[model samples]
Target: MTNDKKRWLILILLAFISALLLAITSTAISIYLYGNKTYTAKAEAAIVLGAAVWGEEPSPVFRERINHAINLYQNQQINKIIFTGGVGEPNEAAEAIIGKNYALARQVKLNDILTETESRTTYQNLKNARSVADNSKLNKFLIVSDPLHMKRAVLMARNLDMDAYPSPTPTTRYSSLRSQIEFLIRETFFYFVYLVFQI
Candidate 1:
């Protein structure tokens, strides 16, 4: 290869290595940040971020999060459960309704649960939940979601000045790998933008 071509190849290889290293580092940080059990101490509430619902029923992903939250409630790790999510597409049930009904079916008392049916994204979920928490006089909370999704949720909660800990629900092995990779990339880009513009 020509010297210029060889140099370009080396630069490309370095860039690829750097990207790979960054991905690995981010994944490790996510696991570390999200894998801990944060509900060991009693909290005022546990918030289960919403996933998609199918025809007014909780999807498997949403069920997993609700199950985790229910476990926490049953164990007295949290005093209340907050289900957050709104209907985004027609024909799909609101996530909060699906979550509330699922817990109710499991015999969780209706009075013990609060629903925020206005948030359509993780950021909004935290935003709406924070409002409820503030009004309820809850200063600490455990935020529950899929392990891979918890990092962003935790960061968003902290950015909103909420004292939040991550309590990730069980996810199918490899189910989140692709989406996690995409999220990591997108988050990195956005992080840089936020740093630059403080947005």
Candidate 2:
């Protein structure tokens, strides 16, 4: 073959290999992230990860997660609900407070609701909630959130040695799709870096 033709062929082969590797990596990550299941049986508590609260109310995404946790309580799947989120802004109201109020409005008992209102991110949410649960001598619990976030939550919980299962709530269809794609891409890059450092 001509030298130029051989170089072009080599470039095409490299491109094909790169595409295949990307596809495989994406598929594996998707399966890993999407395979977590919601809690189905009784547990010590249901921990709802906080999202933004709009004017002392739960955002739509936050509301969905709170409602799902409430449903678990109503069904006796868990005895307590722990809402975790920090204050969004000065006087903006804590995400946990908003989630707690949302459940209270739905008739969840006051004492059964707990709040970890100092977590500004998912890792912190799980960390703070787990600390409270540990103090209370609770063992198993459910982590409630958007589906795309469940796997990360579960992994974090396991890393902290908590017996946690995911219980994702319904998210807005278009938003869920968009969020999933964005998270998948971002996490793929993050995980690649993580792997590089063996983290």
Candidate 3:
């Protein structure tokens, strides 16, 4: 090809690469910033997204999320709690039930707690929780989860057309810098996937 044409082609390629990198960097920053944010508005219920259950109990990560929901309940920010998760392999107990029990032990009333033991992904969790919300005539919700997980969780909730607000757990088990970075990378990738594929 002519030198002029080759020069233009290289410039275009460089621009494209730069734009892609900038987009990714901005997205990561947005995710990080949003995760650290909290919303304290009152909602009809707080939907505690599920994480791994250790045997019959909540894993540290899951417990933080449950604890956040409990705090919301105690503060009267929400009137009900909806726990979501299906059974994880090698553990017969469902994540939702385990979360329910954890909340129950923490003094949350059984009458105010709901469980959907069929969701295995963030999308499914909110989708199933919306159905549960509908049956109970609950319209608004506070989506409770870890800080880094809030961005994706709230996105999925909004995509599901649910009136939801983010309420990330003040304390996260991913406390170390390395672990927090790892979680951020994982969340950023999933956020991209969900944005592009709506999955």
Q: Which stretches of candidate 3 lie over 4 Å from their true place?
A: none
Better candidate by TM-score, 1 or 2: 2
Residue 192 of candidate 2: its Cα lDDT? 50
- Cα lDDT tens digits, model 3, 122-163, are 999999999999999999999999888889899889888899
Question: Candidate 3: TM-score?
Answer: 0.96
RMSD of 1: 4.2
lDDT of 2 by residue, 74-139 (tens): 989999999999998898989999988888999999989888999997879999999888877789
Considering only N, C-alpha and C atoms within 3 Å, which residue pairs clash in candidate 2? none
lDDT of 3 at 49: 93
- Badly placed stretches (over 4 Å) of model 2 are 1-24, 27-36, 171-176, 187-199
Provide the TM-score for each candidate, comma-separated.
0.77, 0.80, 0.96
Number of clashing residue pairs in every model?
0, 0, 0
In candidate 2, where is summed lDDT lowest over 10 consecutive residues?
A: 190-199
